[model samples]
Target: MKKLDLTKQEKEIVEHALDHWQASNLLDVDKVEELKQSIEEKGFEWKTLARYAFWVALVSLIFSVLSLFADDAMVRFVEKFYETPNIVFCLFFAGVAVGFYVLGFRNKEKYPEKTFSNETLMLAGSFATAACIGFLGQVLDRTTSHYTLLFLLSIAIYAVLSVKLHSKLIWVFTLVALGIWFATETAYHSNWGFKFWGMNYPLRFTLFGILLTTFAVWGQKRIHVLQPFQSTSYVVGLLYTMIALWCLSIFGNYSSFDAWTQVRQYHILYWGILAIALSLGLALYGMRTKDNVSRDIGFVFFILNLYTRFVEYLWDNINRTIFFLLLAVSFWFVGRWAEKVWSKGQSSER
Candidate 1:
């Protein structure tokens, strides 16, 4: 029989188990050696290198595109193209988007392992789709900002494409479009004011995150088709909430830096408290439900919230030396606590 392929970590685990069995006289030394040889241990270094290379290539591609705006010749060429009717421009980019999307879909099916390249093509298609929508909005030329309408269109396009292609990458763009739509719609109505229902943008987004998270949880239970999106929605929702909480903790509801500075940091401590509470709640829920993603996010943001509070409350009031000493001591305790917890978990597993 063919032996199962194993990663380095999995090989180590199996080896440890075999050693335990041998020590207990369940297996002889020769059998242990044979078992070890049967399990192939593959290194993950190449995967790490590939991941970094992919990011470098992606960043380089973005820079190359941006550099086009700096070239006078390219600028002039684009200007001349702009002279064409807006509808024509829209159709041209929309067609390009469709071509790229189809190519990406085919590549995804045929060469599933070429993940980075396939995603790059899909991302290019998404950008083209955005350009098409932008030009289409300009062609329509409503008196209002019309940005909300464009965002809505983007959401619809991305959502539909995501569902059709079963592409989580496009689904992520759909979530982003939803966020942009919410922010822009609120801002347009407020005429770029700081307060919407006595809440700043960060505060409003915090509420928006809560709404999204809640809906994700409910939808996952009630809607069969949305099962694939549950993880994505939950993750994005947590991201939005955590980022907004961080911003809210620092700025509160005040629009201007001056206004914020006028108030004592303790006055805005409630926001920090709320952020910590939410993170802890999520962590507890994750523990209960055995959801690692939620637990990890919760723990990470819990630490972030603590650090943010420390900076806000202590940066100016305490001596630099004292602050560093306190920080070091806190980290030491946290590390020790984490070690104990990890050891306990390992023991339990054994």
Candidate 2:
């Protein structure tokens, strides 16, 4: 078999994972050693370089498209193009989207090793699809900011494509489209004041995240096909929930920044406490369930909540020297704790 070339961190992770599997009797020692020997750790990260290069190539392609319209004659033609019917642009982009999706599918079958190129095509297709949707919306000539409807259309299109392709990248876009629809629909109902039922952006997304995560965890068994997306959904959902919780800890559910400043910062102590407790609970739950997504998010945010509070309550009253000293000591303690945990894991594996 061809040896796998991996970065140092990737190699460590693979080794640790193999060790865990062996410990659990999922793999014999011989297989574990064979797997380890098959993988080589590289000092240079060519995969990272290739990823960035592909992104640059995609961007260059986009710019090439734009540059077609950069010349004065082409600019005049584009102006005239805009004067044409919205359906024309819609149909044009629809064709482009179809072409890209077809090519992406073809590459998956014909050149499966070209992971980045295949994804780039699908990503471009998604962009074209969005253009098609936007133009289709404009073709209707509505007066209201019915943008939510457009995002809903995106959610549907991306969701269908995601399932059709069984592509995690497309599924991520679908999730993003859903989030856009949620936020836009909420703003639409709230007259664009950026609030819903007195809930600010962070508060609304926190609930949205919770719902997404809960459904992912609970519905994985119900929908076997969606099982492939479970980890991504969980991570994205927890990312939303934890980031929103961080904001809530600082802002205390106030719709306006001015209102938040009207009261003492310490007055929102409960919010901070709530955020910390939830993070801790999630971390513990993750450990119990062997869910790394929950564990990482929870532990990260638990530390975040502590640091944020440290700055919030102490920055003003404490001397600068003392604050820096305390911060340094806290970080050192965290580092030591992490080191201890890592050594413990390593020792147990050995």
- Best prediction by TM-score: 1
Badly placed stretches (over 4 Å) of model 2 are 1-45, 59-82
Write candidate 2's Cα lDDT for 60-107 as tens digits.
998998898888888887787667888999999999999999999999
Instruction: Give the range where candidate 1 is weakest over 10 consecutive residues by summed lDDT.
Output: 42-51
* RMSD from true fold, candidate 2: 3.6
Return the TM-score for each candidate structure. 0.89, 0.85
> For candidate 2, which ten residues in a row score worst on lDDT?
140-149
Clash pairs detected, candidate 2: none
- Model 1, span 1-350: residue lDDT tens: 68777878888899989988998899999999998888887756676677788778878988998999999999988888766888998999999999999999999999998887788788889989999999888888667674788889899999988877778888899999999999988887788787777778999999999899888888665876667888899899889988898889888989877899899989988989998998888877876797988888898888889888988889899999999999999899879977997798678655
Q: Tell me how far the alpha carbon of residue 116 in candidate 1 is from the true structure, in angstroms, after superposition.
A: 2.8
Top candidate (lDDT): 2
Q: lDDT of candidate 2 vs native?
A: 0.89
Per-model C-alpha RMSD: 2.9, 3.6
**Could you tell me the lDDT of residue 190 within candidate 2?**
92
